[model samples]
Target: MNRLLRTVFLTLVGLFIVAPLIVILVASVSTDEVLSGLPSGFTTRWLSDALANDQFQVGFAYSIRVAAIATAWAVVLGTSAAYAIHRFDVPGKSLLRAVFIAPLSLPRVVAGFCFFVLYASLVPAAYGTVGGVAFAHVLLLLPFVVSLVGAGLANLDPELEEAARDLGATPWQAFLRVTLPRIRVSMIIAAVFGFLTSFDEVDLSVFLMPADTTTLPVAIFLRLQQNQDPVTSAVSSLMIVGSLALTGLVALAARRAGLFATRKERM
Candidate 1:
């Protein structure tokens, strides 16, 4: 009975998670039958229509650019901060750590509004441009990078770094040669998280994006209010597939880095 119950629970959980994605995939490939609440014979018309739209392509390009820039900045800053906080004894370390991660606790809208006011009121020109949007995205994703990198750093071996230094390597060299290689998985994970956070960001992007430039999420959101069509479903399906692929790649990297070797390693 217990085994049967467990099987049922797992089945339900799988169904719960997969049902929406299945619906989206089906709808994305369905013709007008999607609007009729039934499975239409599969057709690629929606995907073609979505791809033919210039707005979608432009928004996707802008989103990719912004995500790449924001992720790069976040990974650089976050990795440095994580190493400093974890591998050294810094003053106000606990407070600093909390401050680094505090942004994640607040609502995104609140964060967006704060940035909006500060940038618009204080630096109007900067706030109304691509640079401003990228800056805000970095700020929004920094905490994720910091937390993930810090966690990875905490689990790293201090002895390897010490040995490198004892062998006449400078502190910087020891870090770069020994510590960095070991903690690279964390950096990669942080970069992935930062990219996703920036890519899917709506609240911050919506406020920061000027009249001329808009990210994919904001553009799609604006369109959704006016039209709920299969084209939207096609775009959403693509996003879902892209996100899942990225996640799979990250997971593979983590596994190769011995991240999931055991429960203790995971912790």
Candidate 2:
């Protein structure tokens, strides 16, 4: 009876989480009347319309470019910072860790506003450009990379590095051949998170995107502000599907790679 109850509970939770997504997916393909509850049948017109629009395509491409670049930067910087903190005996290590992870604690709006104001004051023309967006994204997502990579580093067995060193491997070679392979999962996770953060960002992108440049989230937001229709729903559903697919792939990959295991299990 207890096992049955647990299974039922999980089933309910799954339904609760997935029902909305299913509804959105259905609505994305719905006709205008179905969308408005006026009694029309399913139609793909909205999807076609969304796809045909130049703004949607441009914004999507822009978002992809920014997210890819930002994820790369975040992984590189975050991994390096985590490695330094984990490997070196630095002064005020606790304080440094706190400082490095501080960005994650700030409200998104507050951080975006702060960056916008500071950059405007220093480089007024920087706002509303790809560089500005990438910079903001890196700042916002850096903490995730640091934390995730740091966890991997913390749980790493230093004896492996020592063993490699004793085998006549140089420090660089040992890290490249041994340490990096062990932490590759953490790096992938950080990259995925960084990409998602940049792709879905709104507050910062709103301030940073130039008049000619926009991201998918920002574009969707602006469109919603002006109108709400099946077309809007279609775009939203597409974004949701894309995000979920990426997240699902990441989770599956992590599971397959044993990255989701506890430290004890990994050991």
Candidate 3:
């Protein structure tokens, strides 16, 4: 009885969470405005129209570039920081860890506003540039990378690296040959999380996007502000599909590489 109740509860929760996505997916293929009742008819024109939009094309490309750069920076910095905190006896370690994860505590709007004010006052030129947006995203994403990689490192046997070092391998070589391969899955997960986070970000992008530039989320927001368009739904549905596809691909790759093997299976 308890197990049946739990299953029912979880099923309801899942439906609640997925209800909005289902609506959006239905709306994307709708021929008319979806405010009143069911769609008048089904059509694929909205999807094509969204894809052909020039602004969307530019925003998509820019978002890809920024997300890629920011994820790279976050992975490198976060992994090094996590490794250091795990391995070394640095002073004020507690405080240092708190500082690194502090950004995760801030509201995105507050963080964006702070960045905007700082850039506006100190380096105005950076206020609306791609580099500035990427930097802000890096700040937001660093904690995820650090925490995920740190968790993976916690599970890893430190003796592997030590054994490599004992075999006349240099410290760098030991890290490259031993430590990194073990944590590669964690890093990949971090990169995907960071990329998706940056790609869908709107609050921060709004403050940092230049007059001539915009991101997909910001574009969607602007479209809604002007009028309700079917194209918006089409674009959103595509993003959802793309994100799911990317995640599926990653899972497939990980499975193929035996990353998901249980201890019993390995034994």
Candidate 4:
């Protein structure tokens, strides 16, 4: 009875999550402009139109660029911070961890507003620039990277790094050769998370996006504010498909890199 109830609950939850996606996917291919009711006919014109939109194209390119840069910075900085916190005894370590992860608890609007206020006061010129927006994205994503990579670091064996050092490797060499290789999966996961988070972030991006350089999510939001159509659904569907494809590619890469071999063995 308990197992049946659990299965039923999970099925409902899955349906709740996936129903909107199904609607969007269907609407993306619908010939009808009104998406409130059933779709009239199937067509790929909306998808084609979305792809051909110059604004969407520019926004997509900017989003990709910013997300890539932010992901790289977040991974590098978050990994270093996580490694230090996990491997060393630092004063105020607990406080530091709390500070690092505090953004996760804050509302996105509040975070964006705070950043806007700070930038407006300290660096008004950077308030709506691409670099500034990217930096904000990095800050927003850093906590996820730190948490994921820190978990991996916590699970790692210190002996592996020590053995590398004993083999005449310098501290940097030991970390690069031994520690990083073991945590590569976590790094990849963090990168994926950061990229996706930045790409889909609307609240912060809306505030930070410049007039000349908008991100995809901000563009989508602006479009929605102006008008709603099947084109919006098509764009959203493409984003969903893109995200899924990226995740699959990352998982395949991890498998090829032997990151999952131990788990497979245990299973």
Give a tens-digit lDDT track for model 3, residues 67-120. Answer: 988899999999999899887799998888888899988899999999999899
Clashes per candidate, residues 3 or more apart or on different chains: 0, 3, 0, 0
Q: What's the CA RMSD of model 2 in angstroms?
A: 3.1
Angstrom error of the Cα, residue 150, model 4: value is 0.5
lDDT (0 to 1) per candidate: 0.84, 0.86, 0.89, 0.90
| TM accuracy, model 2 | 0.88
* Pairs clashing within candidate 4: none
Q: What TM-score does model 3 achieve against the real structure?
A: 0.95
In candidate 4, where is summed lDDT lowest over 10 consecutive residues?
Answer: 204-213
**Model 3 segments beyond 4 Å from truth?**
263-267
Instruction: Kindly indicate the candidate among 2 and 3 with the higher TM-score.
Output: 3
TM-score of each: 0.90, 0.88, 0.95, 0.95
What is the C-alpha local distance difference test score of candidate 1? Answer: 0.84
Worst 10 residues of 2 by lDDT: 31-40
Q: Candidate 2 lDDT, tens digit per residue, 76-160?
A: 9999889989998989888988988898788888888888897789987777777777888898888999999999998899899
| Candidate 2 ranges beyond 4 A from true positions | 33-40, 248-267
Query: lDDT score, residue 155, model 1?
Result: 88
Q: What's the residue-level lDDT of 5 in candidate 3? A: 100
lDDT of 4 at 157: 93
